[model samples]
Target: MNKKRGQQSVVFSIPPILKATAAIAGPMEGEGLLAGYYDQVMEDDLAGYDNWEKCESYMMEQAVTTAVKKSGHFMMDIDFLLAGDLLNQLIATNFAMRSLGRPYLGLYGACSTMAESLMIGAMLLDGGFGNKVVATVSSHHNTAERQYRYPTELGVQRPLVAQWTVTAAGAVVMENGTDGPKVTAATIGKIIDAGIKDPNTMGPAMAPAAVDTIWQHIQDIGREPAYYDMIYTGDLGKVGKELVIRLFREKGIDISRNYEDCGCMIYREDQDIHSGASGCASSAAVLCAYLYPQLAAGKLKKILFVGTGSLHSQTSYQQKESIPCIAHAIAVEV
Candidate 1:
């Protein structure tokens, strides 16, 4: 028997959007969406991410701590750390774990890092490499903006569907045991190219990968559409989510009833709320605060959480190159 351990459960968490940003940008359509997300997780009253490095660090720390606390475990109990962030040199994630004081194994899959970490941690512990593990993926809208988009000084109007990289972070603790929520299945996403180039537009950048992974998950598992309770995607936002619905129907797989997009689930764009979504924190927050609770409460039975990312280069965009995307799914059966 491969008696290493089976995934007993996984817990995810995140901070709320800032109050001032929500107050200001909330009324002004989608402007407050970024600020509000940052506000929820940050300590200082940051005007923007120009000097927001410390803010990002703080968010990661909170995410890690929150995940640990909620999982009925301690930092030392975690055998290893699986973490990543879309920060320069991955400082946000690295610094966040410093306080954790546990052994670490870093990973990066852009926005898909959370699911990547969780899925892999489940594999490792289930395979006997470790007994208990922690996995996390974080992104800050501020840091993301500085790296991918023009500086704050540019003050350009990004596309509405161009999700604001959520200025947030999320973490999960997975233990090899039994009698709790378990990872029943997973489907890794392949980097798919749909030929999108603009950093300000991520819907097209991430939709193809979302489509590919969702399809793969159904195909590999050989399950019917009604097998799961809810099907969730990370940050395909409104446009991409709609496109995914259409694509699935075209393929004779109809999952509209319980299908949900994390990006679109939390906020609304029609009222100009939450300004699409473009951060690791985007899905993390939804999964942590909203989705996890609902799942644990028995309101939801089976969930397929797909994390999607746009692996585009600013340099490549400047040169008129297309953007590529990737997605991965983590299925938790309660």
Candidate 2:
């Protein structure tokens, strides 16, 4: 049967089930709003590792292992692993996968990797390619700062528009099952550049892409804003969240009631994170720790998870090129 839904979406004939999920976060995130939902919280960002990158890899490994355990499966039973991170060439994920020893596919969707991995994993299961798959992503504040901006030692003064990169990792075990929330459908997004050149203004740079994907998902799925219990945009902090609302309002649609950004949900207002959180783990941690439980508990019947990404590198920034962004949306239902 053809599963293609619309121009950019596909309906899974056999929706893949999310068997279990895990979220591991650093100390600062442990003090955040969703701390109670996380599976594990480290005392510090390093977690006794020698470097922040190694710490990030450790978090991803821990998250994936915990999720697999929660799903009542062994590492050897996992048919495939799909993961990514913010570091160059996905080194964090590579190192983590080296320890996992499973067949793997590395993805690089910037901050949108979590949703991208989930979408692909669901496709694998529905296509009869894998019975069990683990989808995960990780990001570290120290690692992101040194690679994308200035070193943390430099103590660069961040603008109000800048967001804090989250130090966290999240993983979910997906399988063909009758239990748990199902991956119902997904919409693939296209790259959109709003001519925003400042890397620090990532929220603004990615907002247009988030808007585009959300609009397309709604259009292709024939669902209105009120259809889902919540619509979440990944890592589009306060600035981008408001931009999405404004842009939608201009089109005679109102999404403020059920719409929220995963970035805004991570840190407390008084945490002094400026615009809020930004990183691959921003949405990954939230989805695994919070939304999955909500769906499993029947508190939320359905949700649209839209992962937003800013596709800019240090090289592109140095060349003074505009920031290109994308977003992928997955519909999850209990």
Candidate 3:
């Protein structure tokens, strides 16, 4: 794993851990920076036109473009696609893939889509379904608001810990006959509830789902945190991540030493950010952008990236109720 990122490899793992690998996520924020085209697209209230739709479409395109570039592979060369997005309709992901014209298995797991897609695509390739596959997931603050929580015109202040529906996209190209984690075993997650009341406090709402999936992974495989070089949970931010650590430790499992929550690792508070993370693309961008580069450099030998999302509905919010959270973890080896 990339501890003390940009400093040096803080931990060491056995060599030649895995060979099969690729990159596909992107970034949207930076110091005093806004990614430009996004601002233009998002500003458009044109044609009753929605920017979230545009951003989602763009995320897929960006991921496809990124995968092809990073792997030095082409779009047509891909055999299958596993893709998704957190939306009322899976339009963004599907439309993005439609442009690529590759046969695919469409999917949705909210923020966890990238990991879900990766698990399935890897299994497809490793199972000999195809020689190559591509996986991607995308979400947008603008579009998701319109569909799930609010309309663009509202502009209400989001909670301090609220996640920014990541403005970018993520993707990866998977190739067979390479030495990586063999897609050996997996446990599907079920929704979990904590009965949290605040609509703005997604952290508490999503904690149970994170715990549920983490618990299932350990129970099904009968493994401990030490079994993996790193255990990562997608976008749980500081609050949910803390809850997960406490809950897991009580179960005689300790993931804290080598564990990281993508939500917390990617941002700095002094950097004009609070509570550290937001967006479906948070984990995707990290995996494809940062982790892939490190893996190729022989830094990370094995990693388990878990993606988490709140599955609350609009009705639930209006009813002054709690939200359901869902999470999925995908273990990726060098």
Candidate 4:
């Protein structure tokens, strides 16, 4: 039986294994340091599509297909498709699912959808409801910019604190097997509001939520910071990553030794990505393309992946509502 931990976590007795993974990134990411890690790199954000949204859908389609193929399974072998994106109504995910012809579930966690899908998929597999599932997410710089901020056509000036939304997609195939890393625990975070309303400064807005979830996960699992070889957070960027370290110091726990943000890892300093990267793919691409390989190679033994999101819509922002943030944590072990 699964044991409930503390207030918001669970320890699984039958953890699900990650069978295969794939990641596809756009031109900007392709030029980054981890370019060699991705399976496919698009020369342009349009990806030969008429518009950016459709291009995002195409990226997701390719990611899922590649992941399934790498798993040595056909499309029919997948039991469920769990996915989402940054677009309103998840247009990218919906369109991709329509063509995949698989039983699917749509999710919206702003940028945290990747980890959310993985956790839900793990539950289904561990509970014997399914033997195989695919979790995927995508985001496009052009599509997200016009919807959340200014139109890309205008070439609006981005603030120094602003983060670039990544044009990428990533997918992971999970199954009941002993060939890979297993998800051993999960911590579901609660919504946290820190009275921040500036959409341009999302790192500050979402940092508190990430810290909250990280603290809870450690306490609930009764593990110290040294328990994991490393701890990775979704997209907190440089500023937000520092804030997490400071916040943890205030709580008498230090995580600086084994902590890194995918946002900081995705882009290079000369890439002009402002602070760093953000989006659903900020974490997904990094995990699938880089971290998974390290774990599979026995370079890393244990890790905690925390997906963070700022839950705010254009309407909510226009209404002067502060951003509400959330984070979910998954424990992965080789």
Candidate 5:
């Protein structure tokens, strides 16, 4: 009955099932490799909104509604809604929640929000706090760029290490059911700073945090690297993925063959996405649209999803502080 596993990890006594999920991507993402997997792909980033932030909110709303519809549930059936985004004060999520009209909890984990929301939603269900919950997150390329870096109109020449903030939203409805992938366990990560100051290079900044939580999850759950069909890191891109493999190899574990980064999975080489994708939507879109189907079809039996976040703000960057990163892991099984 005791679900506590080890430090910062827990196994749910009553694992929450992901009943259904929905994903929506912008034009750029719609043109990417996983376009076929998404439920809806907008013709443009604005989707008729006047501004990019409103568009982000609209994306979140669509994702949430589509997910609820797919679950064959009414809005009133949802007990709680958990969501987040990269915008300041979680503007996108706040506006979306307004339309959702559900009891909501706003989260902020940077790009790692999807996994964070999932872990918290699982805890709510298993702890008898709720019977059903929806976990969601969103990010907009233009909004993120203007807020975190430079204005898109400036035509800033990005470095090869920089990642594109995905213009998309993803949502999953989790409930007490046996119909889909189950949330079995979770490992919460701590803030890890390796003194990486460049915001453009978030992959490397977040790799250490990903490795730390992954190692902790293995230790806590007594699972080997081969236990899962694949291990996914959210938005770590190519650089961070390699760093993770090397880090695990040093600990006598080989994860290279079984690991993939959602960042690397979303974009194609010809898309000019620089390093890869980095946003709350990066992992959320991939997981909901792609991985969920694979799990439901029994193509993937077990998997570890680690959401990686570079916890840096424009103020911090301007202050010349190092980027602090975190990663949260969730174990899912069919």
Candidate 6:
């Protein structure tokens, strides 16, 4: 059967179920709004590791292992592992995979990695390529700062537009089953460069891309904005979240009522995170920790998860290249 949907989407012939999920957060995140939702909260960012990078790897490892254990399966039972992180060459994920000793594919979707992994994992299962798969993502605030902007020791003054990168990791087990929330459909996004260059303004830089994918998903699936109980965009902080609402409003749609950004959901107003959270873990932590439980408990029936990415590198920024962004959307139902 043809599972292809519109120009950018596909309907899963057999939606893969989300068997189990786990999230691990650093000390800062443990003090955040969704602290209670996480599977494990670390006492510090290093988690007893020698460095922040190793801590990130440890978080990913723990998240993946915990998720698989929660699924009532062992690492040997998993068919494949798809994971990523926001470090140079994905060192964090690579190191984590090394310890996990599972067949793996490393993905890089910037902050959109969690959704990208889920989309591909679902496709693998529905295509009969794999019976069970693990999708995971990780990000560390210190690591991101050192690579992307400045060293944390510099104690650089951040602008209000800037967002805090989350120190966390999240993982989920997807398999052929009817026990949990299922991946129903997905819309792959296109690159959108709105000529934004300032990395500090990532939320605005990625807002247009988020809107584009969301609009495309709605069109491809023939669903209205109200179709889903909630719509979430990954890592688009307060600024980007508002931009999406305004863009949709201009297009004669009202998404403000049911829409939220995972970035904005993580930190509290008093956390002094400036705009909010940003990083792969922003959405990953929220999805795995909070949203999954809500879905499992039937508090939320259907939802649209849009992963937003700012495709800019330190080299690109140094070269004065504009930030190109992308977003991928997944439809999940219980």
User: lDDT: which is higher, 2 or 4?
Assistant: 2
lDDT minimum window of 10 residues, candidate 3: 3-12
Off by over 4 Å in 3: 1-28, 32-50, 152-155, 179-184, 319-321
Q: Tell me the tens digit of each residue's lDDT in model 5 across 113-215.
A: 9999999999999999989999999999999999998878896688999999999999999998777899999999999999999998999999999999999
TM-score of candidate 2 relative to the true fold: 0.99
> How do the predictions measure up, each by TM-score?
0.84, 0.99, 0.82, 0.99, 0.99, 0.99
**Best of the two (1, 2) by lDDT:** 2
Error of 6 at 33 (Å): 0.4
Q: Listing every candidate in turn, what is its Cα RMSD in Å to the true structure after a full C-alpha superposition?
A: 6.5, 0.7, 7.3, 0.8, 0.7, 0.6
Q: Candidate 2's C-alpha lDDT?
A: 0.96
Candidate 3 per-residue lDDT, tens place, 1-334, comes to 4211121111112211222233222243432122221212222322143554865676577667766665667778888888888777688877887788889788877777777787677666655677778887776656776777677788687667666556556777777654543334444567787888675677667777877776677666666768878888888888878888888888877778888877775555665456666567777766765666666665886677777777766877788767777777766665
- lDDT (0 to 1) per candidate: 0.67, 0.96, 0.66, 0.93, 0.95, 0.95
lDDT of 2 at 287: 98
TM-score of model 6 relative to the true fold?
0.99
Instruction: Estimate, for each residue in 1-334, the C-alpha lDDT of model 6 and write its tens digit.
Output: 9999899999998899999999999988999999788999999899898999999999999999999999999999999999999998999999999999989999999999999999999999999998999999999999999999887888668899999999999999999988899999999999999999999999999999999999998898899989999999999899999999999999999999999999999998999999999999999999999999999999999999999899899999999999999999999999
Q: Which whole-number lDDT from 0 to 100 does residue 180 have in model 4?
A: 96
Residue 215, candidate 3: alpha-carbon lDDT: 69
Residue 34: error of model 2 in Å?
1.0
Model 5, position 32: C-alpha lDDT score = 91
Model 3, 32: alpha-carbon shift in Å?
Answer: 9.2
Q: On a 0 to 1 TM-score scale, where does candidate 1 land against the true structure?
A: 0.84
* Model 3: residue 10 alpha-carbon error in angstroms: 30
- Give the Cα error of residue 151 in candidate 2, in Å: 0.9
